[model samples]
Structure formats: C-alpha cells, structure tokens
Target: MSAIALRGPERVVIHQHRRALWSAGALALMGVAVVVAAWLWASSASDTFAGSGCSVENTVRGCGDTVRAFLDTELRFSRAVDYAGLAMMVLPACVGMFVAGPLVGRELESGTYQTSWSQSVSPARWLAARLAVPAVLTLAGVSVLSAFSAWAWSRAKGTYYPRGDWYEREVYGAMGTAPVGYALCVLALGALAGLLLRRTVAAMVVTVLAYVPLVMVLNRVREDLWPTARFLGGDRPGGDAWPVDSGMLTASGRAIRLKDCSGGAGDTAACMRDRGGVTAFADYHPASHFWPLQLVETGILLALAALAVALAFRVLRRRHG
Candidate 1:
C-alpha cells in the first residue's frame, strides 16, 4: 500500500534526540563533576575527622575542642553539599520543565510533529522517542547526583551538617534513590503536560507547578510509608533515630503533646505529672529505615510516572489517530 512509510521511529528518535543528547551530555558531565567534587570533599572531611582522632564512638557532644573545630571544618564541606544538594533535588524538576518546553513542546507548538507523522513516524512512536531519550538522560544525570548526595550525607550522617533531623524534606529529597524517582516522574509528567498544553511556555509552567506539589506531598507522607519504632519513658533511642511524633500519654490514656506539658512553676517532671501526663513516648525511624523510606517513595513516584507516560500515549493516540 502507498500508505506504508519509509523511515521508522528509529530515525525519528535520532532526529529528535540530537540536540537533546547534547544537553544530556552536558548534564552528564556536570553530574560527573559533582561526583568527583563530592568524593574529594568527603576525602578531605574524612582526613579532618581522622586528624582529630574522633571515632564513631565520639558523639558530637563528646568531642573535645580540637575535635569540635575539626568537625566544624568538616561541616563546611557538608554545608556546601547541602546547598548543592538542594539544587540537585530540584534539578529533576528543572530538567522536566526544559524537556516539556523546548524539547517536546516546541515541536507541537511549531507543527514539526506533522512533519514526523508525514514521514511515517506514528504519533505514538514519535512521542515515545520524545519521552524516552530524555528519560534515559534524566535517569543518568539524576542517578549520579542522587548517589553523590547519598554518599555525602552518609559521610555526615552523625554530624551536625545536616542542620536538622534526617527526615527533613530537603535532605530526604536529595539523598538515596528518591531523586531518580523524582526525575523520572517529573519527566513523564512533563511529557504529558506538554502534550496536553501544546504550548511551550504553558507546558513548562504547568510541569513545574505540578512537580513541586508532588514532591512536597510525597515528602509529607513519606514517614507514613512504614511503621516507626515506639519509644517510651526515659530510654532514649539512638542518635540516628528520626522522631516522627513525640507526646506524653496521660493516666487517662489521653495523648498530650510535649508542648502542652510545659511546667510553669517548679519541677517540670512534677508539673507534667500534675497535668495527668504519665509517660512520654516517641515514634521514630532509625537509620536502618532510610532505604525503606527511600525505596517506597521511589516506587510510588515510579508508578505515577508510568501512569503519566500512559496518559501521554493516550493523548497522542486520541489527538493524532
């Protein structure tokens, strides 16, 4: 039949991916640079710790003045990583926005998609190539950043550089496999948004707006993914434990928040007792739960990404078929 075409999706992918590949190459190089920098900084920080003769047994409070200074010095590197880590955390969203706008949106905006369709590249295959090239690149770049971020944080886990608890949103987003998840999800969503919006700037804006809230929502619900260990009484959990909620349980079995147990007069403990606060308990996740939380979130994000990709395909089929 004359309806049959000459060029396949392979050529369509190659043509669509040339400039995208260049950008991906640039991002890959930047990821490599970040990894090298993180390794060097970690090595220096390790040396600083070794020079101070501080072992894992030495808590932050237990360190001597010399050791404290060394830790502070080590923290400079951690702080750098922290700042860079925020960017890495957001990088996937940024990449998705770019993919949505110039990469995917421009073709739709400028009618180049018709050229591809005319060349025997079906809309589905063209869209698949449009999404796939950037997906691979997004994974590569963000995976490197995620690995380095995880390593850097691991190097500083017991230290004070993290500035807050391990469950902190920024810290959690950058470390582990979560960033890769964010990247893939964002990219897929970007593709779907671009396909729906059919305008470059609009697609970019929509992708970004959609991405930020998803991240925040995931962060908020992440702790609930698995059961946290419950601690009661004066027995403190290990320093690596991240407390999700802490409160006082009254003799009446009512939960009183820790903030509400302020002892105004003399002994705080006595005042707490007077307020019917019998025992205090905390729910926390230990360091061992890091991967579990990370992987669970990753799984959720990946599923969302798959859904978005499927939606993109459906939209393409409906629009072009």
Candidate 2:
C-alpha cells in the first residue's frame, strides 16, 4: 500500500487514485473468498466417494445416488471456478479501459497533466510514474487472483461434474502467467490509446477495440506457438492431448484429406483403402506442452507490451517536449 520506492510523481498518482485502488483490493479479496469457498465445498463433496470405490466411469450398484449427489455438488463448484476463470480472462480488457479513460485520458483531456509538468516534473517522468504505480498494483492483484483461481481449478478439474481440460480457452489463461502478460500488455496499450486520443471515452473505446482483436488472434494461434507431436498408424495421443490436425496418410507418405472421400461413404474405411490411405495421422500437443505454450504466448504478449510502452513514451515526448 505504501509507495516507499516511488517519489513525488508516483506518490501523487497513488494518492489521486486511492479510492479506486482500495475498491480494486476489495474486489480481489472477494474473488479470493469465492475461490476458497468453492474449493472447500468441492473437497467435502469428493469425500463422499472416498472408500465407496465409485467413479464417474465405473459406479457401484448401490452408490448411484451418492455419486449423483457428489457430482451435483461438484458441478456447482466447477461452475464457480469456471466463472472465475472467465473473469480473469476479461480483467485485462477492464484494466485497459480504466487506464485509458479515467487514469490517463481524463487528465490529458482536461489539461491537468500540464500542471504537473510545470512543477519541475518532466513529461516522461510523469508518464512513467503513471505507468509504474498502476503496473505494480495490477501485477500484484492479478497474480494473487490467478493463483487462487488455479488452485480452485485443480480441485474440480477432471471431476465428473464439469469436465475440464488444460487446453480449454477459459481454463488456460487463468491457470498460468498468461493473465499477467495479458494485463501488462493491455495496460500499455491503454496508455498509448489515451495519449493518442486525448479524449476519455474515445480512448476507452479504442483500448477495448484494440485489446479484443489481440486476444482473439492469440487464442486462435495459441496451438502453433510450440511444436506438435505427430502420431501415425495405430499410435495416438492421449485423451488429454490437444489435437491440432488429423487426416489419413497415403502409402507413399503423402497426406490425404479425409473429406475428399466423404462423398461416397458406403464404407469409409474401404474408401480410404481405395485411395491408398494406409494409416491415420494426427498432430497434437500433449499435457507436457502446457508450460511451453504458456511461456511462448506470454513472451509474445510481453514483447508487444514493451513495444507499446516505447511508443507511448515516444508519443508523450513528441507532444509535450
């Protein structure tokens, strides 16, 4: 809470936004509470089948009711966690809009930032202070929420109620450093938008517009961030693997489009054989590629953030200096 490492401009920034900071803290605390409560509820529910030797795949004859009850309870918990994950995903855009509108654009639009610059504070220093204070607070808050979210996910995932996967869009970002990367990226983008637009509402809208497309692109290309494992013939990846592509392989090792033979499907297998498709092929990323994918995507986001930060500073200098 104390801006001891921060000097005049930074401390002033913190003071100016004290209420918003406190509200953010309160919200983070509420998120933690929800995650903890749901985790406890799910854990207690899991105990019902501890020694009953009952599972979702294989249920004992008399344990059906008990298993159903546990699944129902776990389903609620799963929903809570999934919702939290979704919130985490949306948080970056929220942060971006706030930074663009009230934090930077309002001051710029009202010409209040000039007052600070006249007080022996360089424009670069003022902007740096604005970025630094929020960056630190945002990083700390998001890291905590993501950690708790990941903990909650670990408890209910792979359970009978709401089956989850690591590669799932809602589950992936919240469970790793990707959220932090996204937040920082959007924060920088927001600042840049604020500086460029110099209008509160315009900056906010532009920030969100920019952020949404970036997220969509990243999500679409996420699987290609790392190398995929290939399986051929009867070999196949595990159930938990993230499938990238699949098709049939010809005898000459050429890949064939499975859809091409779908026109006359008297026997699909026979059609494949006629087309010289001797084996099935698949490309996927196993569970082991989780960290690699996370790291690579995070690295890309951080790189974009750094670029935006540079551009923001450059724009500020050109306009103010």
- Spell out the clash pairs found in candidate 2: none
Best by TM-score: 2
User: Once superposed on the true structure, which residue ranges of model 2 sit more than 4 Å away at CA?
Assistant: 48-69, 257-275
TM-score for each prediction?
0.78, 0.89
**lDDT (0 to 1) per candidate:** 0.76, 0.86
lDDT tens digits, residues 1-321, model 2?
Answer: 486665799899988888988898888788778767876776777885676688777886888897887877777787888788889989999889888988899999999998998999999998898888889988888888878777787777656665468898888988788999999999999999999999999999999999889989999999999998988866668768998877778878887765666777497666777788888888899999999999999999999999999999999989887
Name the weakest run of 10 consecutive residues (lDDT summed) in model 2.
Answer: 155-164
Clashes of each: 0, 0
Which candidate wins on lDDT? 2
lDDT at position 237, candidate 1: 84
- What tens digits encode model 1's per-residue C-alpha lDDT throughout 155-239? 6565555444567787778878888888899999899989999999999999999988997788778889988988888666877
